[model samples]
Target chain A: MIVKSDEKYSTLGSLESELAISGLKSGSNLEKLLKAGYFVVTAELGPPRGADRTVIEKKATLLKGYADAFNITDCQTAVVRLSSITGGAILVGLGLEPIIQMTCRDRNRIAIQSDLLGAAALGIKNLLCLTGDHQKFGDHPGAKGVFDIDSLQLLQIVKGMRDEKKFQSGEEIEVEPRFFIGAAENPFADPFTYRAFRLAKKIRAGADFIQTQIIFNVDKFSAWMERVRALGLHKKVFILAGVAPIKSLLMAKYMKTHVPGMDIPDEIIKRMEKAKKGSAKTEGLNICLDVIEKVRKIEGVSGVHIMAIEWEEAIPEIAKRAGLLPRPSP
Target chain B: MIVADIKPFKEIMRLVKNYRKICVIGCGTCVTVCHAGGQKQVSEVAAQLRLAAKLEKKHLEVGEETILRQCEHEFIDSLEGLVQKYDAIVSLGCGIGVQMLAERFPHTRILPGLNTKFMGAPTEPGIFWERCVGCGNCILAETGGFCPVTRCAKGLLNGPCGGSQNGLCEVSPDTPCVWQLIYEQLEAQGMLDTMEAITPPKDWSVGQGGCGPRRLVLEHLVEEEKDKHKIAEKVLTRNDCKK
Candidate 1:
């Protein structure tokens, strides 16, 4: 039980009231759930490319109670979309929690800080900082990328704003925008031995929690988790294993072959290929549920972040089948 | 050294079509070494321009010249009176040389025949890779001598951003991730701890992010010029008083 379905307000007044209720950093529902020792389930929501609020409203309705918090993506793959902050506000108005994903690909520090403030003011309390996908993968490949600050710096900056009551320039902030900060890690990427150390860097930089790149190979993820546990980094930050329900065999093959920093086991691809025709999607969902089940048993994994890319409809069913339904009250 | 590429012939022709007499000038330093603009290149360009004019049945006079360094005032001064003979001068020099030529001969049209690329060195016989962006503040000592500003696509100070995989950048498979090289270099030196420490945001104002154009003034050298100017000013004032 998060916010009541009928209770909705889109203003700083409501946010201030929510903040006043708890002495916690952000007092966000997700943070409250995590603090209460609830195994969380978060999902990704890609904002529409055009200015159609109904598109998001519909998606929000589908995912209203499935997860502890919904992550509103920021121009994922560098393709333009309705801004994450705007999308977060929409979810806020719908009485749902949103974890706004902020990427370093498009905005500089000035814009980043300004947007963070706006997001917080609009009742957004959770954030996931990332060094976004390269612009070449997007529709606007010819566009200029403005990664004035990397994801680590972004986390540090947001932390400074929240905890220290100051901006990156060391200027005092009157009303600091408190946020439950999160960062993304890709353990599947190269320099495998260094991944744990990198996660430590994110934690030191102010990441309260982390959602890793979509996991396809549990053995590698578990190995990385063992390293994380060795360094005691798992104690410092909440770790969420990222999972995505594969839509089709072609998608599975494409991700394995083309997507960088993604490791899809050959056996997983073969499993999807072997699925009877028209049953690939069901098999994909099963695979996702299997990953979720495996990751849940791993020590130090706080939750599962289901990234159902474009398949938002599957989330409720996945949540129901995974026993993640009836989300705990904040 | 400055790397540059010669402009397309059609663009060069369009730039000089209005001028009855045009001189193609090449720099003898970086451009020569890069085999882009040199004495030999100037000769070839002059020949091509002359032949093109002949084919077009247009009456045109083309001259070729090469200076030791078009960027230096002394070298450009050597061409002083002779440069005025041409209606326009097409400079096949790096951007600095083209601007230097334009500054010296303000009245004559100084057209650029080459697009200055970057400050870099050749990796092999023909391929040149950018090594520095002249950000003014150098952090190479801490970075194991690999420049993230010049090499990393995002110019990230704390980097190798998830895009680094298999030692290559996500931007392009051809481009090697400089952070990976820096990490390895630091690891070899037993400085992996250096990579772990959080590097703060860079002061970009020292680089291109600064206001307007940037200049480096050597105070010791500039003081001597100021003294000379003072002496000349005093001499002029005395002459004026006498007059």
Candidate 2:
């Protein structure tokens, strides 16, 4: 049974007791770890395209004790997958904390609000809000993009629902969906300069934590972290630097060339190319470990979000090699 | 001005494939300034249609006319004698102009030669960008003059969305993220505090979603009411003369 924390749940008034035993609290283990100043480590899992609970369960079980919490991607890259809410709920049932990802690519405000309420009712605590990948990149290239509210406003709306106990329309919610709000950032995308200011806007919008896009260039990321620290934004929000284990030289080249926001460095690509036959995966893991180590040392970075896309088996080893294993208890 | 772009030459030709005699009407106002619909544009379109018909071995008679404004009945009445000879009229104005032509000449087929894009101004020669969605609510004072409704991909009122990078939109690298421009302008003007205040969801009722065609009428402009005011002035003048 999930016991709601009295301190945070007391704001629920009389409804606290009814939800105390079953409902998830606003504060999550990830939040607890960040609050306690412990170096947090989280992982991401893309929900399968088909509805097979066994696949989700296996992945969650693999990541259970290693990651503080695992994020279930919401139609990542515009490809429809098992709903993040359902995947998150399944993970919850399997004794794993899940960060349900929600994107504005597919839903309008009514659907977004309804799903948020449903997710909360299902005992899902953590939510990572995103403006999702454009539908042009997805399997359904002809699909319409429903960006009714972009990620920033979604963050504000969720924060309002959680903190002010009111909907976007100002209607009072009988039972507020207490969520540890999170938002994503791509430091390498463009105009290369305003990333930190955009992050500041997200923080002001009530984002409790931030997860960045995949980091391949340590120098650029460190520079961004320096800017983030300069603005004193590090103290305001928990920033989780994103690190993805490149599986092969081909994958690295594809991401560097094809992906819009990814900034994979030439040196890393050359290093991967120099890898001996059958050693590319090992080299990739080494690159991931090196990035984790370098990112952990950044002043403003609070944690590392490991996105071993479709490579769940590498996470346990990557976490252990990065010295992020032996997960702390909240 | 409501800016527009001319449809592709082939598409325009295809639209008038059935008509042997076509009259192309261009607006002298907004479309003219944007270079989409004007006297020159009308002549160019008429020339292209004649050339296309010649190449296709079809006999075609193309005429061109420029009106002060196609949306007004006064300007549209200029086509009274000229329209009867043509099988169809291709309007080079915005959507308003095309509809106005249709409303005035119900029996004549009205085809839009230009695609009505948006209410915006040309940033430079031969370039125009949409600047307004006509949400009927103006928040330029709060936004440092950059409109999120038309400029932002998601129409977010609060601030920049996460897809913003290096000050560009996530949808396309070519599109400069307007929110970044707003932020810089606000920061430069020392009015960043205005951005902190959450802008409520717009009241769309006054906008495109609320109802039928929007109308605005000044009560004092009514002709009958003006006559009453004229009579009242006359009575006051007579009383003044007696005094």
Candidate 3:
């Protein structure tokens, strides 16, 4: 079942079912990683642009105890931010588990392979791969992009690091990191049905977890999850459904229109718009709780990440409403 | 640069309390590099603003637009279609990016969220240190690789002052002694004695001049000038945009 992760979390799964299929032993560290059949724990972290460790330290400290693992993005959108490798190392130093986010836009195959080995040397255990945003979307529109590989190809590289136990050429490193791979999906923005097929492919490739984008509709997400289950891939990995609490009616509309795969029905919008003058945000929070309540009853939802952003403190309250009250100790 | 930091969320919410249709125009450049402005930050800010507005009993129609960049007019013009709809635009970019938005949408009020610090270069991976003062001149050839004009406490250009001890700057512990860097670099290149042979005072006028910017016109003559000019002067080509 979907258990809250503020403290230690336990999943309702026959550990044997997960390990027997994947060939990993029960009581393994991943007994926490895989649950029922789908693995769902995921969180997002971005690289800071200027060099000040304060931001990273604060974020890691606040989130380490709550999230299963957090991701450090590469020069996301290629605007020359801090490198994910450096940030990942900092997280390691801080005792927070981090996922090294690598994008192919800035590195060639040689550099990509080199960075992967370096990441392993740093004892990083998780990875999230992306094709990266185009240079046009970054500060350096004039800068050239190097898309020598994409996410799928990067997944193969991660697998090669473990499976082949070596680099692309067959030269083995002194150490190899076992990566629990994950990829992103936007149900509202994807070509309706491609999500399941694509996720199945990612699972077939090596992804252990799937993190969906900010989800506005829980029922719609469940519908998508049902299809992925029917693909008989239910016993393969975990799926963490993303939840975004609407801060305002305008934000509700923005995600609905601009963000891909984030669908908020008119009824929910009307509920917020029709709420009492200053109570619209309150109503929006309730709407999110309603979705969470409905989603918890669904068969396969692993857990949720409340992207409270500046409103991270409200997470305790939202978690309470969603039946995700912090589970203490065991 | 306007030394502005993203005011805490409550402050931004309180400032724009009246505006209903709020458009958050995030930059995909320096601000993005710093994490103050970027798609993820825009998304996070959009989410945060929504939460704050919810508490205040107001509804804000926030639009998320991350353009190619806020500095380029062509990219700034990219917001033409949606500019008419917003009541106010909260810019997540740096000072220059925010100004670009103001310059483009003069009618629509613009707000800044990040504090732009200085004209600094990336010290290492994600660290940027103030390097160039935009002093209207560059004289790196004589000072090894360090610029005394920018790193020196007194903008000294001649030789090491009495304060340079053990190769550390006297002004601050964090500051590296630029003269020591010159000494090390020159010694490595076997030009330490040659540089010391002539330690003349520098003409600081060109730098301190009214313009207050640097210019480098030392060696402009090149055999491939016509070809270089043709490439730049040519109408922009999209051929290089592909992988």
- Residue B15 lDDT in candidate 2: 93
Give the Å error, residue B56, model 3.
64
* Worst ten in a row by lDDT for model 1 chain A: A4-13
Between prediction 1 and prediction 3, which has the larger lDDT? 1
Deviation (Å) of A285 in candidate 1: 1.7
- The number of the candidate with the highest lDDT is 1
* Per-residue lDDT of model 2, residues A215-253, tens digit only: 989999988878887877776777889999999999999
Q: Model 1, which residues run further than 4 Å from truth?
A: A1-23, B229-243
Residue-pair clashes per prediction, in order, are 0, 3, 23
Summarize candidate 3's per-residue lDDT along A192-307 as a digit string, tens digits: 44456556666655676666666767667877878976875545666667765677888777765554235778887788788898887788788877776665555555666556
Question: Which residue pairs of candidate 2 clash?
Answer: A190-B166, A191-B166, A192-B166
Where does model 3 exceed 4 Å of error?
A: A1-41, A77-79, A275-281, A309-330, B1-243
DockQ for all models: 0.60, 0.26, 0.01
Best by TM-score: 1
Interface C-alpha RMSD after superposing true interface residues, each candidate, one decimal: 1.3, 3.3, 27.8
Give the TM-score of each candidate.
Answer: 0.93, 0.83, 0.51
lDDT of each: 0.89, 0.85, 0.66
Ranking by lDDT: 1, 2, 3
The A-chain TM-scores of all the candidates are: 0.93, 0.92, 0.82
